[model samples]
Target: MNQFVRIQYVFIVALFAVVVAVSGCRSSTKTYSPEDVVHYDESYDASDKKKIVRDLVDPLVQDTFPLARQTEKPILVVYGISNRTSEHISTDGITDDIRMELLKSGKYSFVNETQRANIEKELNYQYSGNVDPSTRLQKAKQLGAEYMLTGTLRSIEKKQPRQVRLQKKTLKYYSLNIELTNIETSLIEWADKVEIVRESSKPFIGW
Candidate 1:
């Protein structure tokens, strides 16, 4: 009788251990699908843009400045940037980045758009209904801008789908097109294009 009781107790303990082990194994299984994971590295670096612009624009501006030394200081103004891409990109961010780089080079002085607008408003107000031709001419001369900077951003995307593996890979290409124009002559003094590309792949585990 004693031996039978001991054997029964051992059998029950072994069954309980097996049940707990199986439960733990099931809980340890990963739940997230591979497609839920995002894996793309950003192409733009804070320092890289500044370095690229400075390296490309500074020498050109320095070489060009001697020709316009007669002016108190050649003021360059940003006209605007056109987005030729499908993505909703902020042109101001890129222009501002380039502006900061050029300003740091100290080869050219830029007129802020806000300041230009204010000056324009003040000039129009003071000259309104005034018949004095000299005053109008002076105001025009005071507001003259020497150079203009404009640019565009373009993008291209490509995708490859692997039906057998249920996976997709995507590639994105970005281009920044910039040009410096002489406002007086309507001539482009400098033009440069910077290109950046990024690629990513994701696997779909679930149907």
Candidate 2:
């Protein structure tokens, strides 16, 4: 081949090799353990859950309000927190962390209502006579929940109007309202909420 033609061919071949190499390169990923305090974005995350748990459960237990009329630890079933946001956020973490904090305070006992079916199955199996009679659990002897802990997670988002700036900003307001209701009286014994406001800016063209 002519010198110029050979040079052009080599340049095209080198460009193709570079693109193929880039395309074949593996993408990188980072993993954070549960103990890691990492904030990848301004959206709701583990840090927010931790803050909510800390701010939420601490005050409830510290107050003078009687969580239970009796002297024993109140039996509480967490019905779950309803998510009233446009975003598909998982509120399970919020519920779990709050329950954990409440338990740590030694102020309440929790009943896992989510495992009703599994518990029913186990109880039925134990009563079916296949297991030892001494180990069999008594029927209809499960402790009833004296109080229900339920809440709702609400969020409102506002974006800045179109402007000349290269970065666009978004404002998010989040509120978590938690309530303790007496099962017999159908009254809210104690209620409180925690609010968070977050502002984030990102390039308009990309994240």
Candidate 3:
């Protein structure tokens, strides 16, 4: 009986040891770093558009906000971007990129028009309960935007296909037009455009 009990204890100890060893082996650490570069292809992906906006559009917009170096940081509102392209591109994503770049430059303050409804809902919810009366937000106290940013994304495509050779070539040109308008004065403070052209060749198989 003693020998049987000793054997059971040994087996349980061995199993626990194995479990600990496996758990230790499974533990790992991962490191993260900033991306060094990005490549653009024919596919209509967000990365390519973001790169274009970052590299080209950002600089043009920076030039427009030269007055940022002055004493005050201007307040601006993004009216959202329009997608007039054949491809189902992410116009809202592009608008976010533009807003991010502009904000990162420390040149302007932004009033998020897109989130206004959500903000109103939250304020209403807070007013219902769980919010301190003294610290509660007031809708009438909201800051007005001094300037508005608006834009459109457009694309032009040219395609040529040779049935005999089973070869096809396509050229796609994308253009982004943006404007900064003074809200009170109803004047365009700045405007510019950035364009990108992509060409691709592929074969039509078994047609």
Q: Highest lDDT, which number?
A: 2
How displaced is residue 61 in candidate 2, in Å?
A: 2.2
lDDT by residue (1-207, candidate 3, tens digit) is 699999999999999889877774457875433343343445566556666567644554455456566567888898977989898877888778778887887777899898899999999987997899889887677889999989988889988754566667888888888888999999997887878788877767631
Each model's RMSD to truth, in Å?
A: 11.4, 5.2, 14.9
Give the poorly placed runs of model 1, Cα more than 4 Å off: 1-73, 119-143
| Ranked by TM-score, top first | 2, 3, 1
Residue-by-residue lDDT tens digits, candidate 2, 147-199: 89899999999999998998889888989999989999999988989998888
Can you write out model 1's per-residue Cα lDDT over 63-180, one digit (the tens) per residue? 5556334345567888767888777666776678677776776666788885778888777876786656566635546555688989887778887754676666778777778888
The lowest-lDDT stretch of 10 consecutive residues in candidate 1 is 34-43
Whole-model Cα lDDT per candidate? 0.68, 0.85, 0.77
Q: Which candidate tops TM-score?
A: 2
Q: Quick one: RMSD of model 3?
A: 14.9
**Candidates ranked by lDDT:** 2, 3, 1
Range of the 10 consecutive residues with the lowest summed lDDT in candidate 2: 62-71
TM-score of each: 0.59, 0.80, 0.73
Candidate 1 positional error at 204, Å: 2.4
